[model samples]
Target: MLDATTITAPIFIEDMEVGLTRHLEKIISDHDISLFAEVSEDRNPVHLNDEYAESTMFGGRIAHGMLTAALISAVIGEQLPGHGTVYLRQSMAFLAPVRPGDLVRAEVEVKSIDLRRSRVTLDTRCLVDETRVLHGEALVLAPSRG
Candidate 1:
C-alpha cells in the first residue's frame, strides 16, 4: 500500500518538448562550500583554505567547479525534464571561479527530444550574474510512459 511516508517522483515525460527550459538559483555560501567540500571529500586548498588559495591563480578561496556545475543537475532533475528523469550523460567546461556568496543562476534548455527513444538533449549553463561560470550539455533518458 502507498503510505504517506512513501516518497514518489512521478514520470512526466510524455509531454516533454524541445525548447523547454528551467532555471534554478542558489547562493553559494561559505557554509555551502564547507558542506560540499565535506560531502564530496574534495578538500582542495583552492576550495577550502583562504590563505593557501590566496597564493594560487584565483587569488583566494573558490568553490569547486563541480559544485557549481551541480546546479545544472539540480535544474534538470527538479525542473527541466523534471522529477524521475534519468541522466545518461553530461559534459561541462568550467569558465570562471565562483567565490563564496555568489548567486549562481543555473539554466537548462531542452535542445531536442526523441520521443521514440525517450531521450532528451539539453544545453546547460551556470552563471554568476551575467558572467558564465560553467556551460555544458546533458543527455538524459526521459522516462517512458507505460
Candidate 2:
C-alpha cells in the first residue's frame, strides 16, 4: 500500500548478504518529539509534559518508543537494503527511556534471508551512550533489481 514516492532504488535480493549491517545516529530533541506527536497522534503526557512526566518513573519527559524505532526504518530504507525495502514486521522491546538530548545510535544487522520470497530478517537495536535502550527484529520485503 505504499505510494510511489516511498520506494527507492532497491538493493535487490542478490546484492544482500547475511552479515550486512548499518547504523544511524541522532540526538532526540524536543522538536523531534513534538513532530512525532503531531504526525503519529500519540500525545502521551510522559513524552510531552515535563511536570507530569516527572511524576512518573521516567522522572522527566521521554521520547516516544516508536520514534527510536523509526530509526530502524530509516536504516532499512536508506542504508542496508537501501531504498525499496518494504517493512513487513517489527518487534521491539523498550529497555530504557530515551530522553530529549540523548544521543542514540540505531543499528541493524542482517540475520537471515529467504531468497525465494525476497524476504530478509534483521536484528535491530538502539543505544544511548553505550546503554542498549531498545532491541528487536525486523522482517522486510526487499525489492528486485531485475
Candidate 3:
C-alpha cells in the first residue's frame, strides 16, 4: 500500500496567512500516465510510446505535465484550504520532465488572501530531488467556515 501524509493542516480564509504552506510527495508511475491519458484524451505519443519518445528532445517517455501538476491540486483540495475550496484559476510552467520512476514533491504556499472576496492566491511548485520541475500560481475560492 502507498503511504501518504499531510504537510500542513486545512486552512480557511479566516485563518490563512501569507506564508502558510502544505505539500505531498508521490512517485509517478506508468499506470498513472496511462490513466491520465485516457481521462484527458491527451494521447500524445511522447507520454505513451517509448519509441516515439526516444526520438524527441525528452529522450524518453515522460508523464503528462498536467498530471504532475495535479499533485498541486491534490494538496489544495485535500489539505490547505481543504474541502469546499474551488479552483478559480491556475498558471504553470513545466521546467523539467517527470519520468515514470521519478519521485515528485508538490508544494503550495499562500501568497495573499482577499478575505472579503474569499479568495486565496498561492505559489505552487513541484520538485524532484531539490530541482524544481514545475512552478506557478493558483487562485482559489476558500471556504467560509463561519
TM for every model, in the order presented, reads: 0.89, 0.90, 0.91
**Tens-digit lDDT track for model 1 on 32-135?**
99999899999998988989999999999999999898889877776677667899999999999999999999999888888778888999999999999999
Which is the better candidate, 1 or 2, if ranked by lDDT? 2
Q: Whole-model lDDT for model 3 versus the true structure?
A: 0.91
How far in Å is the alpha carbon of 34 misplaced in model 3? 0.7
What lDDT score goes with residue 71 in model 1?
A: 85
Among residues 3 or more apart in sequence or in different chains, the pairs in candidate 1 whose N, CA or C atoms overlap within 3 Å are none
Q: How close is candidate 1 to the true structure, as a TM-score?
A: 0.89
Instruction: For candidate 2, give the lDDT.
Output: 0.90
Higher-lDDT candidate among 2 and 3? Answer: 3
Candidates arranged by TM-score, highest first: 3, 2, 1
The stretch of ten residues in a row with the least summed lDDT in candidate 2 is 1-10
Which candidate ranks first by lDDT, i.e. highest?
Answer: 3
Badly placed stretches (over 4 Å) of model 3 are 1-9
- Clashing pairs for model 2 are none
